[model samples]
Target: MNSRYVGYLFCGLAMIGVGSTVVVSKAIAAGLPPFSATALRFAIAFPVFIVVMRVRRVRWPRLSRRDAWLAIAQAGAGSVGYTVFLISGMKLASAADAGVIAGTLPAVSAAVAMLALGERPAPALIGAIALATTGVLACTIHFDQLSSSRGAGAFTGNALVFAAVVCEALFILLNRKLSRPVDALPLSALMSGIGLAVAIVPACFERPWTLPFDANALLGVVYYALVPTVAGFVLWYAGAARVSGAEAGLMTALVPVSAVALAALVLHEPVTSSQLAGVACVLAAVWLATFGRRLRAPSTAG
Candidate 1:
């Protein structure tokens, strides 16, 4: 198999893990304080990363001061900032709204890549972005649900969710900026440690010790740590290392598609016709973005 195809697979799976977080995080958000939950999630995953590294005999690579700071910033934006904002946002916004707004990630990531990484996208990729954005809006947005009745809180929640999207976009672009690229495992472990450090302080104010524990919430947090936080980070970095920033950005279109599907499965939300249609569109977009180049290339004469 082509390495690029493998990169796409890893990225797609990573987005699925990311999408699962929406349902999981929303479930736990009310029961767990956002900052504390973020802290605990990273804390749980950090040790697991260490164990895996030790088992694999993967030693931590030496980093320059710049790379060290870059790692910290990545943790701040993607690991800590994204989780805090997302959990906090879900407190006010409906999961559907979050999923709808999260649909912006592909565009946000592409724009950020263009601006920050100087990535000039191919025309096919641009079309894929359009298709993806439309698909997410189709899947998640209900025109009937949009009204003045939604209130200021909804707006604030949407804003916070968008903030998470931007942080994630930055996180994607920053990976491309690493002067000396670290392997996926070591980088993920480094990120988990930094995230724990950054989030634990804010978590203190939440008075985590005093909060009553909910078993379901605890389980959600544990799942988040192991799957989304640990596995998602590793898969995303591995894929991002193999692909262009723009391509990685485009892969984020899968996030909301995964979110909507998981919501139906886990929350038992009914799947709507519009949602099914949206899924089809997103799949087409993925196909176009990943294979359009080959399709456009002229075939050799027999």
Candidate 2:
């Protein structure tokens, strides 16, 4: 199998993992507060990541003083900042809207890569960005129903979710610059360890520990920890190692589509016509961004 194909597959799976997280977190939020839920999710996953690193015989690298702090900062922004903003956004906005807004992470990442890292995007990618932006607007900007509370809240939440996406994008861009002298597993473990500490302090104020005791809540926490936090990150980083950051970012579009679909089915959330249109646009953009080059390539002279 081609490495790029494998990278796509891994990234697609990671998106699904990410998509499921919104629903799972929402369910848990019913019983626990948002920050508490976020904290526990990482706390459980942190140990599991550490165990995996040990099993893989991955060793941590000796970082320069500066690199060590940078790694910590990356973890803080990606894991800590992302969770805080996402959970808060979900509280303020519908899960569907949050999911859709989170889809912008690829565009955010592409912009950061261009401005900070001197990476350039192809024309196809630019078209995809336009398509995605249109889709997001179509999905979110319902002029006919502007006065409704749900509609207004969804728009606000989408904005915060976009903010969270930017933080996540910045994390990926920063991590790309870090010299990876350590094994991926151990490095991930260290980052997650730092993230756990960062999350704990704020989580205490939110008091997620007192969430209503129930089977659904337990399952939600377990699923979040195992699937999204641990497995998703591992697959994502593995795919990132083999693919371009733009390619990886494009795959994240699946997260919103999957989340909306799953929410309609499991949570009984309504799937409106406008939302469907938005999904189509975003999908089209993702396809162009990811594969347009191959379709436009000139035939070999041979």
Candidate 3:
């Protein structure tokens, strides 16, 4: 029983949770305002995380002043901020479009890595960025004969999702800066708490009871809270313990793929040719950007 193999299994399971988030989040938002929905999701998940930490007897990380601010800022951008944009965008766009748009995240993160971390990218990486951009444009533009309000809303929603990706990318970059890093589980719990705090005031302001409360809404919110945040984080960090960063990056492909399939099946969203093309290009870009170094062949002996 190799630990690394177990890590892979954990990570694979986590990827499924990440993939289904778009459809589930969209469903949750349908019955609640974006702020209220995000607040509810994090609020519900945060206490569960506290319980898990306590039950596991996890040693909490003592944070320095800088680390405290880091947790707050990171939680804002990555957790609360990203969720807000995502739910709002999903309300406007089809789940399938949101799913496809998510594939571009790796490309965004790679660009951030180069700029913020001073990593010099190879030619393939540049090509990957270009291809990703082109793909994004293709999916976003509605050049088809049919022009309607739905098309316009989809465009706006997709753009907002892209913005959410940038916030997430920035959070990733900032997370790299912690000289005294905490263990993933405790850190995640802390971050979730921070997210709850950030969302509370806004959630209070948002008109409650705008959406008719029902059993389905309750189910949707519960699923969003437990499945994606709790289970996904646990599995992802566990797998990350065994997997190389490269392999972890490669695994991200599953999110978009699973998202699209789930959106189509669960939400009954149609997948268009342009979106398929965009997904392909974005996947290719991610592969090239992530693995471009290893893919270079060694020089032959003279």
Candidate 4:
């Protein structure tokens, strides 16, 4: 297989892993404080990473000061910041609102690439971003239920969710900017440690030990650590290394699609026509992003 094709598979699988865990996130959030949940996630994942490293005889790569800071910043922005802002934002926003905002990630990441990384997006990439955002809106927002009146809390929640999106975009962009690309496993281990370190402070404030905990949520946290935190991180970085920032950004369209599919299967939820349409749109976006060069050939011809 071509490395690019393998990268696409890895990226798709990583997003699916992340999307499948959304329901688990809801369960964990219901049962535990956000900070504590975030901390526990990393704490559980870190050891597994270490054990795997030992088993594989993979020594941690020594890093320069710049690379060290980049790793820490990636951990902060993507792991801690994204989780904290998302949980905090969801508290005040409707799921629909959050979903719409979260769906903007493709566009956000592309914009970051253009502004910060000096890369111009091709037309296909732009179309993919637009379609992905539209798909998310279609999946999440039921126009009939939309209220004419808005509350300040709703606005705040939406802003926070948008902040989470920005953090995530920055995370993707920063990965592309690494002075030296860290291998996915070691990077995952390093990030898990940094995430735990940063999140533990807020977890302490949550006083998780003093509170009663739900067993199901605890189980959910462990699953989250193993699947989304551990496996997702490795697959994501590995794929991102093989693709451009815009292409990686485009892959995120699969997240909501994966989430909706998992919801239908695991939660036994009815699949709405809108959701089906949204899924189609997302699929189209992915096809456009990956194989739409033919669509571009005529336009670029002199």
Clashes of 1: 0
Q: Write the per-residue lDDT of candidate 4 for residues 179-220, one digit (tens) a residue.
A: 888777887788889999999998999898997869977997
Model 2 residue 263 CA deviation (Å) reads 0.8
All models, RMSD in angstroms: 4.5, 3.6, 2.3, 4.3
lDDT of 3 by residue, 70-174 (tens): 888999998888888988888887777777677778888878899989988888888888878877877788766227877777788888888888888888877
| TM-score on alpha carbons, each prediction | 0.80, 0.84, 0.91, 0.78
How many backbone clashes are present in model 3?
0
lDDT of 2 by residue, 1-302 (tens): 99989999998899988988777766675666655666777789889987886787766678888778888888888877787677667665666766676666666677678788787788877787788788788778878666988777777777777777888988888777777555667766777788778878877887655655767866887898888878988899888878997688678778888888887888888887777777777778767766777777787988
**Ten-residue stretch with the least lDDT total in model 2:** 29-38
Per-residue lDDT tens digits for candidate 1, residues 1-302, read 99999899998899888888888888778789998999999899999999989998999989888988888999999889999999988877656556656766655677678778788987877877788677656754556655655645666776788789889889878887889878879888888899999999989998978978788788989999999877887799889988887688668777777787777777776767776677666666765666666667677999
The better-scoring model by TM-score among 2 and 4 is: 2
Clashes of each: 0, 0, 0, 0
The lDDT values for all models are 0.80, 0.77, 0.81, 0.76
**Most accurate candidate by TM-score:** 3
Residue 10, model 2: lDDT of 90
* TM-score-based ranking: 3, 2, 1, 4
Q: Model 1 RMSD to the real structure?
A: 4.5
Judging by TM-score, tell me the better candidate of 1 and 3: 3
Candidate with maximal lDDT: 3
Misplaced by over 4 Å in model 1 are 1-15, 96-107, 139-144, 151-158, 231-255, 298-302
Error of 4 at 31 (Å): 1.0
lDDT of 4 at 40: 91
Off by over 4 Å in 4: 1-14, 88-107, 140-163, 233-254, 268-270, 298-302
